[model samples]
Target: MSKIVVIDPGHGGKDPGACANGLKEKDIVLKISKYAKDYLEDGYEGVKVYLTRSTDVFLELSERAKFANNKKADLFVSNHINAGGGTGFESYVYTTINGGTTEKMRSAVHNEVMTVYKGFRDRGKKKANLAVVRETAMEAMLLEHLFIDTKKDADFLKLDDNLKAIAKAEANGIAKALGLKPKTVKKEAPKKEAPKKDIPKKDGKLSKVQVGAFADPKNAEKLAAELKKKGYKPFITKE
Candidate 1:
């Protein structure tokens, strides 16, 4: 069975959410959401993913929820960056939703994202009657990646590695929860070539001079720097 996921990047365009510490929630979440979508499309099989808003355009909360409901999506993930004091990763499900797959998804995504942002506190799976979770017909959850207000969190978000890691984890969690499989990659066999005739060996004694040998490349670099100062062009090679 094919699984469908709708990724909603919260806030956009004119509505730049929580602009603090030189980071914008809307922009950061959009990058993460897009990354997740790309990962699912490229790596996961039997899965179809869609984004509510691909561009930096404002979208109504109702519209986002309705899009998933109308599409009959299997899962809905809303991405956002938090602000206003607290610092950490948090995932939320609809408060009215009892213990079920949706709740399990919340836990899965929370844990996966936390693995990458381990520095931040794990806020744990929470419950709230948010529009995206409350109105969507399918399993839905909202992810607050990190606090944009907190300087530490904001700095972390600034790193491209963290964003990519968070996106990958989110996709992986969703794929696992939905029982989706990864796309099969075929490996090509090594090509065989016929044996070649041996060539005549050169009869000459080559003379070479060694400058220095060091296990650490930094030491070799330091020697090279000294050589350059002495008006010599030094080249370093790895053995």
Candidate 2:
């Protein structure tokens, strides 16, 4: 098995990323990264995984790449949700692999991730020297897996099963990139529906229900939890 992996969840804090139907790219990829890490670690032995940030904190793009470089990771997977009206998944590698055999790495990832979602557009191999891709030393792939602004994308991903499917596909993608035999995806315990945001009431009574446009669904859930603690019912709505 490939030795170490670094997963970077893009955008956090002030950088809310794309907004649509109350979902933010930061929160979406955070959920994916956590599950991907779990999917990989449980299914493979001697594989160490680390995330650049596990929460809604922000980091410069370059800093994220540096973390992976510092670790000398075998593979660096930068997770991001795409924007615009487009649908589908595309993987990016540096325009030049600095003479490294990284394009093959990118191809492996592209092939596996595109396997599950047939409707996804094949944005085939492209190049860019983004901070994460250029500065990283090891093989790396930045995934533009899905567009968060579109309902069709959200409808598919919001389902718990779809999220697990994505995680499995990503884990397999990395294994394939490193030219390792694919491993079985460890099954996830079924996840419940995402909790809703809360609303406050007047007249000295906390309302049993409230929902708001959160820009980020996870943020909405966090707000909901806080409201519930304050005796308000909360649910989240999209932009």
Candidate 3:
């Protein structure tokens, strides 16, 4: 049976989460979770991963925990960005349960991710009664990637490359803990060449990836706020 990992991106939609220095926790966590999911799917085998919420959608805390429990996930990892008076990477596991595969998994992920965040302070691994971790049946952990309130941390997270790097580290760590192997990508056989035909030249243009278009300006503004947190200068075009 494949090992099941459920990733929960903390806060979304109605919940803006912790906001500071023009950064929102909801946006950062979502981006990290999405990138992690993609990396694991494309590079690893014998693992099935699921997200509590895929997009900007509000989910109750209980609902998030229930989703993982219902799925019988082998592990639950919740992603979040911190706020208020701290700047660094910190991870949490259940307070009572210590020293086992769970702690090893937490350490594996924390070490891998913190290595990339070398300049940032190492807050160290901790234990807490966080809803998702406490409620989930499987071994669970929650990660505070960095502090949104801290200028240095927020600036680092604002870069797209940093987000991708963090995601890769976490995903790779999870794969390592699960003893996963890279999937074998099949190579296609080369085909015989055909005679060339005349083709017309086309004008070059820049392309943009859009998240959504909303009828209400409030909704549009919300998306723009989230995008801004991701270091995007998004503007809504009226039609």
Candidate 4:
């Protein structure tokens, strides 16, 4: 069975989760979430990814969780950006679930993100009563990508390549957690060149043909004898 994952980009439309360095959390998280969905679906087999909100539209915290439940998702991941004078990345799961599937998923995803977001501080795996994580039916986690208000972190997030790397990591983590296999790509066979046709000359003349060229006189004589047996007017000329 295919594993279903619902990715929520927190704070859209009227609610911009965080704002810093001339960037809005709503926009950034949406981009990262979309990239993550694309990477997961493209790179892995037996997985289905869906976004809570693909556009800059508003969705209540409860609505996000409900959406995941409606899709019967196996995992729910909410993407967010942090503010308030802090820098680095962190992941959160429901406070009550410990040492279960949720924690395992959280660890898998957290470690994957850390691998890509090198040089960024690791805020450690944590527990929270966040609405999305708490309300989701399946194993769920939330990710605080980086402190948008922090200058250093904000500069890094500004690069599209950096966002793509984060998305790739998230996809890889989910794949690992679900034991999803990589998609097999079929390779095309090489084409063969057509055989050359023997065309007559434009002047209606035939090209010269050499049937046999033997260095030894004995070999030449043997070829002539064989041709004569085949009713070919056999002749041997010495060059």
Candidate 5:
């Protein structure tokens, strides 16, 4: 068969990886993994994609790696968000057998993810005993793209457009590292449909929405408030 990719969105169900101001890392990553799969399928021909869990369910780290090894993946990219106060991004590969932290597979994945997300501070790649990286037989890397609990990283990640951009850039990075070229993402944002003449309004005020109706609404609203505090009027509506 052809070289395939196994994408794992770590954490799920009850194990909500990180929760900050209402955002859940597990759920967010799942969406990103799906976005990446769609991009690869439509843009990169013959590169099959497999996800460990498609729904909001949990998978043990061992099972996560087993999925990739069982599928004989050429690359495995596990998606995750950070917690606590860390800023910027980090990627991990298995600790090398020799003195060095990695071999070629580690270098390729680390270079790809970091190069694509050039704006974020380069935290540098390191050898980690992470389950997903070490256990997977295939070349593998795990990405912690921005912090969900930090004030700065969380703010940046709160926007749907920004999250999509990050995800797409990651897809591009993976493609580049793996020697595939991701097709040019469209430059234009799709025009929004005009609001219906008589759509019903809710709550006589804004009601808290259960996220996924849009991405990162809690953080998104916080950012909007910050923007307004700096003299910009921002609006919040479901997408």
Candidate 6:
């Protein structure tokens, strides 16, 4: 069965979760979420990814969770950007869940993001009563990418490539956690051979031998005579 994954871009439209250094959490999370969805679908097989909101639109926390539940999602990943004075990456699961699939997924995702976003502070896997994570029916996790208010973190988040890296990391983590297989490309069919042209024939036989092309008729005749002596049926043709 195809595993269904719901990616929630934390804030949008009127609610820009956090804003700092001219960056809005709503926009950044949306980009990250879209990239993650693309990476997961393009790289893995038997997985269907859905986004709570694909555009800049507001969605209540309860609505996001309900959307995932409606889709019967196997995993719910809520993407967010931090704005606290501190800088780093962190992941959160529901405060009540422990030592289960949610925790395992949180570990996988956190480690993968930390691995890709190297040199950044590892804020560690944590638990929170965040609405999206807490309200979701399936295993859910919220990722705090980095502090938008922190100068260094915001600068890093400003890069499009960095966002893509983060998304790819999250996709990798999900694939690992779910044991999803990479997509296998089907081999192309062998091309058909071109039709063969009829070989030039002299009378009813194939013309296999070519005689000499000489500037002088005498020279051509001499070569043809030699070819005849050698048992080759040679005929001289003038250009």
Clashing pairs in 4: none
Itemize residue pairs with steric clashes in candidate 1: none
Writing each residue's lDDT as its tens digit, candidate 6 over 47-160 gives 999999999999999999999999999999999998769989999998998898888888888898898777789998898899998889999999999899999999999999
**Higher-lDDT candidate among 2 and 5?**
2
Candidate 5 stretches with Cα past 4 Å from truth are 97-112, 115-119, 181-239
The local distance difference test score of each candidate is: 0.89, 0.79, 0.90, 0.91, 0.75, 0.90
Q: Give the top-scoring candidate (lDDT).
A: 4
Of models 2 and 4, which has the larger TM-score?
4
What are the root-mean-square deviations of the candidates from the true structure over C-alphas? Answer: 12.6, 20.6, 20.8, 9.9, 19.0, 11.2
Q: Determine which window of 10 residues in candidate 4 has minimal summed lDDT.
A: 189-198
Runs of candidate 4 with Cα error greater than 4 angstroms are: 188-239
- Which digits, one per residue and each the tens of the lDDT, describe model 5 over residues 40-150? 777864578899999999789999998888899888889899887877788777777343323555565556556545566778776688988889887788888878988
The TM-score values for the models, in the order shown, are 0.77, 0.71, 0.77, 0.78, 0.69, 0.77
Judged by whole-model lDDT over C-alpha atoms, candidate 5 comes out at 0.75
Best by TM-score: 4
Question: How much is 14 displaced in model 3, in angstroms?
Answer: 1.3
Residues 1-239, candidate 4: write the lDDT tens digits. Answer: 89999999999999988898999999999999999999999999999999999999999999999999999999999999999998899999998987988889889999999998788899999998889999999999999999999999999899999999999999999998998999877784445643323446999775545569889989989998887676555567779
TM-score, prediction 4: 0.78
Q: Where is model 2 more than 4 Å wrong at Cα?
A: 98-100, 179-239
Candidate 6 clash pair list: none
Error at 34, model 6, angstroms: 0.3
